[model samples]
Target: MANSNGSKAAARDKRQRLTAAAAEVLHRQGVERTTIADIAQLADVPVGNVYYYFKTKDDLVRAALSAHADHLSLKLAHLDRDPDPRARLGALVASWVERRDITARYGCPTGTLAVELDKREPDGIDTEVGQLFRTLVDWVAEQFRRLGQPDPHDLAITFVAANQGMSLLSNALRDPTIMIREGERLRRWLDDLPT
Candidate 1:
């Protein structure tokens, strides 16, 4: 029984490692350029063992997307600790600024992946990609609603679009300062909004 438990734990660890590596690789290389081998190497697991965790590359991509969603959910949950809705939204923008260099280098992970998958033929994963955006939009809209804003959904959409647009421009321009400057602008915008 002890041995079985140990084996199960090890399997879970390996699966987590593979999923994490897949997310990183997919973000850096975009979906079309990443490979199972690349993820396996990053995870330090043998390529053959990757199959034990994931049957196909798409399965790995789905796992990455799910992992990304889980991560974003955790971040939103953390932001929820703040009492002020505007402060929470500002913190979200600040968090993006914190990763400005990475965003400049790779673009926004969720945004880039969604765009890449969108260009391909319809797959079930595309729906999951949409869910990521929905998660963000819903959370932001709720914050706007808390602030007594009309058309909270529209406000949230604009906020998310601005962040994504900044990320795209930063990446294209290879300039991390764009994220920093935009983050400051967003914080000011949030402050300016009437409560």
Candidate 2:
């Protein structure tokens, strides 16, 4: 029984490592350019071992997208600790500012992946990738609703759209400072929203 438990633990650990490495590689290389070999090397697992956990590259990509969705959900949920809706929204934007360097270098990880996947023949991953945005927009809209905004849904979509635009411009310019500046602008915009 002890040996079985140990084996299970090891298997879980290795699968987690592979998923993390897959997310990083998918983000950095985009799906078309990343391979199972790249994911295995990044995870420090033998290339063939990756097949044990993921049968196909698309399977790995789906895993990465699922992982990202969980991450985004947790991150947004974390913002709920702040009592003020405005502050919570600011916190969400500030989280992006905190990763400006990475965003500038590689673009928004989810955004880039979604664009890459959409450019290809309609793969099922697009819906998965899109859920991340939908989740985000829903959370933000909920915050707006809590603040008694009449058009919470529209406001949420606009806010997310602005952030994506900023991310795109920041990547194009290779300027992390753009995120910082836009974050500050968003803070002001958040403040100015009708109470």
Q: Which sections of candidate 1 miss by over 4 Å?
A: none
**Superposed Cα deviation of residue 68, candidate 2 (Å):** 0.5
Give the count of colliding residue pairs in each prediction: 0, 0
Q: Estimate each model's TM-score.
A: 0.99, 0.98
**Pairs that clash in candidate 1:** none
Which lDDT tens digits does candidate 2 get at residues 114-142? 89999888867888889899999999999
What lDDT, from 0 to 1, does candidate 1 have? Answer: 0.95
Clash pairs (backbone) in predicted model 2: none
lDDT of 1 by residue, 53-74 (tens): 8999999999999899999999
Looking at model 2, residue 36 earns an lDDT score of: 94
